[model samples]
Target: MASRAGLPVATAHRLTGELVSWGALQRSGQDYLIGHRIWQLGLLAPAHQGFAELAAPYMQDVLFVTQNVVNLFILDNDQVLLLERMSGTRVGAPIPARR
Candidate 1:
């Protein structure tokens, strides 16, 4: 981790310990994974709420017309995060997004 971050080993270890103590990282074996606190904080961003609200009506319209499942997602940290899902019995298979 220190080498990857371009920091001294001791400094990296110290920073990792502080982050773990602060609920920002969880030590998993020899690796660190982002903690639940980080996810909670990310979800609290205003953009999430604003985007959900802005997309809600369009999402509803599509759902009403097709009666298919709808997923509201945002790209974050190179991953897609599902923010909302509306579904009925007629849901279809997933479609991959294009770049």
Candidate 2:
């Protein structure tokens, strides 16, 4: 995305460092990804994960009644981290474990 945005490599690197310092980004090997601290902070925000956790039981009840899937998502910045995701499913998703 930075490349697409025409961001200079040096500027991108410096920006990434700032984000990491703020706990908004995590650095792994040579790449950057969402930091766990962000998730920890989300748990503290009343309007976000805090409320979601509180209402989860009710939401689960409704999903059970309707036989539907329940999904929860947390938003984060756009940075790919060096990590591996292993699953039974096979797809062409990019794997950054080699970073």
Candidate 3:
């Protein structure tokens, strides 16, 4: 990790320990993975803000017309991320859904 990051071994170890203490990284067996705090922070960044709200209406419309699953995906870098899914209608839908 130090070589990859171009930082000294001791510096990398100190930074890694601090990040783990701050809930930014977690150890699983022998490997470390991103923790919940990092994921929450990513959601607060500008690129992810309000995307679910802005797409909710369209997702609901698709669900209303097709009565099927509606998934909203965003292409981030090379990964396709599922931002939202509309699978069920409100408790009191105006019209009955098809069988």
Candidate 4:
């Protein structure tokens, strides 16, 4: 991580420790993760929520009728984004998000 960030190893270690202390990040074995604090802050802005809200009622109807997982995707340039998903009561297969 230090190499990727172009910071000295010791400096990166100290900074990462501080971030963890402040709940901005969490340590998961050898990996660092964005913590609950960051996720909570992000919920405040809620980018792309307008379209999602408009589609939500229809999505709910579809879920009610099909009783299956429904996902919404939008093509942005070369990438396709999963903007919304509605799954029935059961937990289906996991679909992880990627950048």
Q: Model 1, 60-86: lDDT tens per residue?
A: 998876777889988878888888888
Clashing pairs in 4: none
- The ten-residue window of minimal lDDT in model 3 covers 88-97
TM-score (C-alpha, index-matched) for candidate 1: 0.66
Report every candidate's CA lDDT.
Answer: 0.87, 0.60, 0.81, 0.81
Across 21-95, the per-residue lDDT of candidate 4 in tens digits comes to 999999999899988787667556566587688889999987876667888777879977667888776456444
Best by lDDT: 1
Query: Whose TM-score is greatest here?
Result: 3
Ranking by lDDT: 1, 3, 4, 2
Off by over 4 Å in 1: 65-69, 87-99
Better of 2 and 4 by TM-score: 4
lDDT of residue 78 for candidate 2: 72
- State the lDDT of candidate 2 residue by residue for 6-74, as single tens digits: 898888878878889998898889777778787677556656646566667766664554444444444
For candidate 2, the 10 contiguous residues with the lowest summed lDDT are: 81-90
Q: Could you tell which candidate, 2 or 3, scores higher by TM-score?
A: 3
Distance from true position, residue 54, model 1, in Å? 1.0
Off by over 4 Å in 4: 68-99
